[model samples]
Every structure is written in C-alpha cells, then in structure tokens.
Target: AQTVTQSQPEMSVQEAETVTLSCTYDTSESDYYLFWYKQPPSRQMILVIRQEAYKQQNATENRFSVNFQKAAKSFSLKISDSQLGDAAMYFCAYTDSGGYQKVTFGIGTKLQVIP
Candidate 1:
C-alpha cells in the first residue's frame, strides 16, 4: 500500500509573496497521475494542478505550479503571488491510470495568506 506524506502541518504566505508546499508519495506503480487539490473550510475539494507520470513537463495552472520529480516521487505545489483567497488546506492526491483505480490523499497542509 502506498501513501502520501506532507511534512508541513501549516504554512503562511504573505500577500503577493510565494509559498511552496511539499508533498511526497511512495508507490510501486509506473503509470499514474499526481494532483494538488485545495479544500477551503467552506468549499469542496478543487483541483489546482495535475501531472501525468509520463509527461516530462511539470503541470501548471495560473499561479499554481507543481515541481514533479518522478524519480523521487515528489510532487510539490508552488503558489505564486499568493492572495488571501488562496488560503486553504492543500491535499496531494494520487491515482493510477488503470482499472479499479483508487485515489489516495495526504494529510494536507493548511495555508494561511497574511495580508
């Protein structure tokens, strides 16, 4: 059984600054996908960014980007130009591109954007 680990219990980023959230996973499968999901206190899980295992390029969405290291199985999320609205609990998720897929999530990192 594989699992995701988040070393940081909480993180704070000043408005207009940038912050990087660390995420690492353990897995034996070759083909899979990594995702960064943001869950606000009053909102549902939202897909922030995703990366394909085979893709060489790191996935990015607007101010959100991923530092995906396939060899080390590390998928970190970098939020640029942080804002108060960006404050949320970020979760790293994983799912294989095969039958009977199961989604695994990390504990989560609580992000605070201080104005």
Candidate 2:
C-alpha cells in the first residue's frame, strides 16, 4: 500500500512571501503520479500541480513548483509570491499509473496568509 504524509499540520506566510509544504510518500511501484490539490473554504478540490514519476524534471505552474525526489519518494510543494487567496488546505495526493483512478490524499496542511 502507498501512503502520503504531510508533516506540518498548519503553515502561515505573509502576503508576497514564499512557503514550502513538506510531503513524503511510501510506494513500491516504479511508475505513478503525484499531485497537489487545494481546497479553499468552499471545499472544492482544485488541482494545483502534478508530476509524473517517470519524468526527471520537476513540475511547476505559475508561482507553484515541486521538489520531486524520486529516489527518496518525496514530493514537496513550494509556493512563491504567495497571495491571500492561497490560504487554504493543501493536500498531497497520489495515483497509480495504470489509468485515471481514485487518488490517495494526505491529511493536508492548512495555510494561513497573514496580512
């Protein structure tokens, strides 16, 4: 079985600052996919970024990027130039490479943007 772990239960950052959320996983499969999802107060799951295990390059989107260490099975999300809207629960998720399937999510880290 595979599992995702987010060490920090809560994180806070000032607007325009940068923050990194830690995430580590345990998996035996060689091929899989990793994802970071954001859920605001609205409770809607939104895909923030994704990384393919087979790819060596880290994935990034706008101000969000990932530090993917395949050998260590660690994937962390870095948020640069943070904004107030970035305040939410960030969840690390994983899915098998077989096909479109359900994802396993971590407990999540709540991010607070301090004014």
- TM-score between model 2 and native: 0.97
At residue 43, candidate 1 shows an lDDT of: 74
* Whole-model lDDT per candidate: 0.94, 0.96
Predicted candidate 1 versus true structure: per-residue lDDT over 1-115, tens digit per residue: 7799999999999999999999999999999999999999887999899999999899989999999999999999999999999999999999989868688999999999999
Candidate 1: clashing pairs of residues: none
Q: Tell me how many residue pairs clash in candidate 1.
A: 0
| After superposition, candidate 2 runs with Cα above 4 Å error | none
List the RMSD of every prediction in angstroms. Answer: 0.8, 0.8
Per-residue alpha-carbon lDDT of candidate 2 for residues 14-113, written as tens digits (9 for 90 to 100) = 9999999999999889999999999999999899999999999999999999999999999999999999999999999999997667799999999999
Off by over 4 Å in 1: none
